[model samples]
Target: MSSNSNSNSGRRRPALLVLDLINEIVHPDGKYAADGYFAQARDRSVLERTAEAIARARAADIPVIYVVVGFSADYTEWPAGSPVFEKARADGRLKLGTWATQVHDALAPEPGEPVVAKHRISPFHGTNLELLLRTREIDTLLLTGVSTELVVLTTAQAGHDLDFRVQVLEDATLAGDAEIHAAALKVLSRIATVTTVEGALPSTG
Candidate 1:
């Protein structure tokens, strides 16, 4: 982990946690592209905004951690009855080692940056995310990613419950619709600090 002078004992060391910015959820050719959610997100340029935030985090020497969702080719780990994973399994998307599961080219994880694969919505669930955070002494998470009503919201709430100071980068996340996105941000404001990408950046001045 790179050191940042802005982070001291008085404040928790911050890391940027990007959730589910995978090709399957972001790219137009992805399996879920038929649903048009990814198309809308791309149209709004959420990926570009996320990339900008990532660049700022890197410049500040803050840890950039990626949380992606994927399943095995057989998808045996995916529960049959679960509404979420079941549909994903049926669609045959997010297969491990496939382009769909891979993070988008626009915001790829550089060498040595931790890329954590998650089986569920929360980054902490069934992943080494908590260990990575604790190991790096990261207590403040700058959350950014797709599906504001799903992964971003769930991860922010989970991070808060785990006693980490969480902030959701509003422009860095996208939902299926504007109302859902706005609503998620409003509810998340109660549990986490809701801010823009620039707001999460370290002050260079």
Candidate 2:
């Protein structure tokens, strides 16, 4: 966890970033469930915790941004030689217009919440996420998502570089296994505040 006193200070303008909670990655019936993300997510109660985080953000009047990874029907934006996304291309998963790319129902975005689509691990890459944050004056980020080693970590590093204070809600995220999740959180602790939803956003009195 980051020791900086201001890491979770209440005064900082914050936005909740829900990353890759789409069906293809975390849903039980999704194509990528065979990779163990679904099991880990279920075992860790990631969806439940993430729901709580989202609700808290909403109650606190914080902007909530959803980032989903998907490709067009023809996949013109798909990265051709990348190891991470190769399986997705091969399996024809993560199609933008399909159920596979939709956000999980448990944590669905409300009527007007922005759902930004990206073709890469980092939400900031080739997406208007940064512009949204800048326009909203969001200087802090509360991250909650699936596959801790991938999107969560990538976004934390990129957000830090972009000078936004980043906090990863540990209980609201997981990897393919406990060890991988822990290791990723350990690495993220140095650059971002690794905290639980409660720790980052206490309930109102």
How high is the CA lDDT of each candidate model?
0.84, 0.91
Instruction: State the TM-score for model 1.
Output: 0.92
Residues 1-205 of candidate 1 have per-residue lDDT tens digits of 2333324566668999888888887788887766656876777888898899899988888999998998899886676776767678766878888999899999999999999987777778888898898888888899988789889889888887777888999988988778888999999999999998888885575
Per-residue lDDT, model 1, residue 17, is 87
* Model 1: residue 127 alpha-carbon error in angstroms: 0.9
lDDT of 1 at 10: 66
Q: Write the per-residue lDDT of candidate 2 for residues 48-114, one digit (tens) a residue.
A: 9999999999998999999999999999999998888998778798999899999999999999999
Q: What is the C-alpha RMSD of each candidate to the true structure, in Å?
A: 3.5, 3.3
Cα lDDT for residue 27, candidate 1: 86
Query: Number of the top candidate by TM-score?
Result: 2
Alpha carbon lDDT at 87, candidate 2 = 82
Over all chains combined, what TM-score does candidate 2 have? 0.94
